[model samples]
Target: MSTAVVPGIEEIARVQGRTVRVLAAGQVLGGVSFGATVSLGALLAADLSGEESLSGFATAAVTLGAALCAIPLARLAGVRGRRFALTLGNAFALAGIAIVILSAALRLFPLLLAGVILIGAGNAGNLQSRFAATDLATPRRRGRDLGTVVWATTVGGVLGPLMITPGEALGAVVGMPPLTGAYLFSIVAQVAALVLYLVALRPDPLALAQRIALSAGPSGPVVESDRPVAARYAMLAVAASHVVMASVMAMTPIHLSHIAHAAHGGHAVETTEITLLVGTTIALHVLGMYGASPLFGWLADRIGRVTTILAGLGILTLALGTLTLWPDEQPAVVVGLFLLGLGWSAGTVAGSALLTESTPIARRPRRQGLSDTTMTASAAVGSVLAGIVLGGPGYGALALIALAIVAVTALLSPLGRR
Candidate 1:
């Protein structure tokens, strides 16, 4: 079970290096798989459900799935190690991918929702992989190592949305419904991730770290700091940031589609053309979400974690301002989405790093799992509410609602300081 006993710090560093690289590779594939979900999930769901308001349910379902799985996956990592938990998660995604294809072919909205929820469960692995990078890391380099893994998602994140054309072409060969073709590309990518986890993740990071902590005796290496920022603040920051981002991001595609519909005089717009616009915009957003993670991580380590988190909130507020001001402009939407991604990256990195350093080694996994669950569930609620808001007050209203959250989070963040 996840063994590769390290004799010393040097050996541990070597192993940590290997673990980061492997996890980075896995992240690349995970990012690719997620591209389809974010860019096309709402589109496909709306088309199948024939109810525009239900579009948010796509994002909600996936996030809820991840929320439900977060703690269980963490406990699994605690018991069986990350290798087993990550691989099992990937397996669920693979099956979900198959189900999505079948559901799309049959035009079954409920089945599609089920498939996507399972895919979200698989996403728990992607979320946790960054934390795994910190397992053997010394306190000094924890941010950098975690950010490196986060940055690796940039490549796949940018490319996954761009896969629409080729993915559709590949799917036409097999007669898949339009948006569902992107999931075809996802299948291959996720399979690669599954194999990578099974084959390369030797000396499981969490398990090995647990062993090392246990060797330090009962108290577990005293990871707690004398006046560390309240872990609750870090968790709250993460959850709040995620909610704003997910709410706005989840509604974007549908908003754009409405524009397309209006532009075409209420005539049906070609799905491909709509997806093209969505793919490009979402690609930029994904790029922002992951591209500067290293810088954010560095800032967290150098400039104080709370400061970095506040900066992220500021960016998020500005992003909402842009979207609320120009709700109908595609270029403006692109800029806003990109900013949203950047803000998410900053908050997620600084907040997660702070939470990690603040927590005890023995409690780290459970606490981190709780944070993920809170973050993911908050996002799920936002997305569901986003659909209702978008359906009622429209996109600008949605952005303004998100803006209010950024303001609230920024005001409360400093109080988390011990």
Candidate 2:
């Protein structure tokens, strides 16, 4: 009986490992798809109209979709469980990719936007992957697990732009025009992600969490969860960090375009170099976002989440200030962008850990969804505002605005103090 029990326990452990690996793979693939979509949007628009604004719109559409769906999707997962909720998200991605591919083939920009919206809905699901990791982890290792999943995203994200070259190559052989094949690649990635999620995420994490909660029969010296001041401050910090990150990151290509124009004596710039620069910066930004997540997550678990949050905001302050001073220098600009990515990763990991630890498990999903919604919504607003600001007040004013928001975050951090 003892021998049999030992084998059974080992099997269970093995199965759980498989489940986590599958979930990780799903997240990684999702990251690849998101990166591909972001990387390809400008190229797609350039093919269609050469209007920079259309690319911005395409990017914003995805954020809007995530902002709209974040809470609802979280609630759905909370009630139904991870398997069904994640599967639903993958389905949306699959369909969205299909629509995008079809739109590209047919040369329809509006339909492409709709497809992006659908993909954004899928992104909402992908963003929750960290939370899903938390649900399965022991409290002591929760941050590490969450960070590990995030780190996996960097792996696929780095590869996403490379996929575009292959996509274009395939397009050449298939005769689907220039950039239409990239969307087709997106469809394949999304579908593969869906399959990975279905096959690997076997025991639904939400359901497992519910079972664990039931067995633990909670009773502890829980902090008072009714502090509206702290919650609101936390929300603001999250939103501002996101806004700064998005505004600066999203506007990079526009900045590079201006640089190219200036180089050419104030005329419209060449295409290939601009594309390469944008692609490279985005990939670097993604690397910055995920590379240090594990370290930050571990820090949040030990040194207090609020302190980490403040530190992240301070990093953003430095990053934005650097950009303001050296707006025209490419190396400086790229380094500043990397700092923005690092700042965002720190804030997001710490903020999420704080929110999770502060709330009850039963209400975790709803609150998490709300936080994500606010973050994404603010980012959408920032992207649009960045375009306007870039055209008018330019990078100097934008960097100053980001600094002011960081100052606000610093002021609010005291609310979480005991």
Candidate 3:
């Protein structure tokens, strides 16, 4: 079913304005819900298992669930439209939160895993929010629109940590633990998102897209209709960048700990201090990721997408090289992380905009879905691989791995040119 129908360009323009606002709201709420649960997975797992090794399992379960469902979920969005898929994903997330609450009450690990998995599937939906924004935008404004939605996410992500505090207080009142209460907050956020999307997103973007497709009357090789090798390369480069970012970020805590220990002459930094530093680093990185999106989008618009993409790779290369030079310095580590975030933002906006530009409307959803699924999977791989490499080859080695990926992304620039 269509969310809203437009008769022509004027109508489309009016609809587009409303659609962007609604989509941005959805992105923000989605980010909050995602952040609420994800930020504390380790603590929940530790409370359940009492062992650090098993705590990793919680994250693993979630990522595995998302990875498994990513491609299928994207295809589902393509066929069913983003509205239905997004709503269903929210439902899964709600159920997951409920399950976690129940599991925490009963002290059940398996149930926790189940809950986390569902949350991961919800994340699959969350990742596509940017792509959904692109659907209603014109070529000239595609990246900006996409970046705006992505930027909206920053609001919710920032609020998520605070959500847990209130959740904990409520849980204390209700006889549930603070952690269990956090899941309830997640449920509430997801439900609110569902309502906002259902009401505000209007008829549906995909349906509007179909109507636009029918109305356009054979425009110059509809962007979605054609798929060049360059498009595929763009997708690969985006995914690879995600992989490298995830892997390196995953091991940052360990790397930082090593630095602390060496600096202390074999005595590691206090756990609390390390945690605080890591938290700050991650927050800064996320800011860098979303904060610069608009600028990157603007850059992609002015320069060719390939040029922006290559610039991102060049930044990434420099960031990795810096890390390699001073793996133990906190300032350098922070700088590297910030640059990594900036590079990802640049590559993501440029590459995704290019992908949208290349494909026709009919194929856009599925292809975009494919791109997201691949990127998500790559992120999962990078997270796991970073742990392995950090344990064995060391943090410096992880920097080299990032450098290698940057090289590959740089090589793909030619594809975008063609």
Best by lDDT: 1
**Cα-based lDDT for every prediction:** 0.87, 0.74, 0.73
Lowest lDDT 10-mer window, candidate 1?
A: 218-227
Clashing residue pairs, backbone N/CA/C < 3 A, model 3 = 2-203, 3-203, 3-204, 4-203, 223-359, 223-360, 224-359, 224-360, 225-360
Q: What is the lDDT of residue 324 in candidate 3?
A: 87
What is the C-alpha lDDT profile of model 1 across 71-125, one tens digit per residue? 9998888888889988988998888788888888899999999998998999886
What lDDT score is found at residue 117 in candidate 3?
A: 84
Give the poorly placed runs of model 3, Cα more than 4 Å off.
1-6, 36-38, 42-60, 100-111, 161-185, 216-225, 254-275
The whole-model C-alpha lDDT of candidate 3 against the native structure comes to 0.73
Q: What is every candidate's alpha-carbon RMSD to the true fold?
A: 2.2, 4.2, 3.5
Q: Tell me which of candidates 2 and 3 scores higher on TM-score.
A: 2
As a TM-score, model 1 comes out at: 0.96
RMSD of 3: 3.5
lDDT of 2: 0.74
